[model samples]
Target: MASVARSLRKVFVGGLPWTVGTNELRQYFSEFGHVVNAFVIFDRNTGLSRGYGFVTFGNPAGFNSALNQQKHILEGNVLQIQPAN
Candidate 1:
């Protein structure tokens, strides 16, 4: 049998300071669910956050539910949540 790939979602989170790192991002995403992982995309040269990143939830149900209710003002920025590739 083929192993099933995990169901993960991505989010567009902007308005973070350049100092924000993966751990902080993961902690912020934890409010939605059990964050399997979180990372802020960065530029190769400047090594700065690209103003967005991905967040993966360990539980699919929790992830989808979060997509419906999670939004701006709480994080101080409007975040876009969507299915990952």
Candidate 2:
């Protein structure tokens, strides 16, 4: 049997509004491509957004499309999108 290798298709989203939740993040990014998963990091103590999050795409094409945008506006905040290391 052979194992399949998948290309990296995850992006790091920063400068997110504290009010933005996982659902909102997913919804916004869905416009660019098929969002496999999206999540906003939260502070464990306050349960508030950590101002950063991650979005995963089903394929690299979607990831590239999103990366080309470089920046996005959501909830009146400018979001920084970058490829996840």
Top-lDDT candidate index: 2
Report how far residue 4 has shifted in candidate 2, in Å: 10
Q: Model 1, 9: alpha-carbon shift in Å?
A: 4.2
Question: How accurate locally, in lDDT, is each candidate?
Answer: 0.68, 0.88
> On residues 18-85, what C-alpha lDDT tens digit does candidate 2 reach at each position?
99999999999999889988999999999999999999888777888999985699999999988787
Please provide, for model 1 over 1-85, each residue's C-alpha lDDT reduced to its tens digit, 9 standing for 90 to 100. 2113354455555666666788988887787778877788899999878877777777776577667874543245556666666
Total clashing residue pairs per candidate?
A: 0, 0
Candidate 2 regions exceeding 4 Å error are: 1-7
lDDT score at residue 57, model 1, on the 0-100 scale: 76
Q: Deviation in angstroms for 55 in model 2? A: 0.1
Residue 15 in model 1: lDDT = 62
RMSD of each: 2.9, 2.7
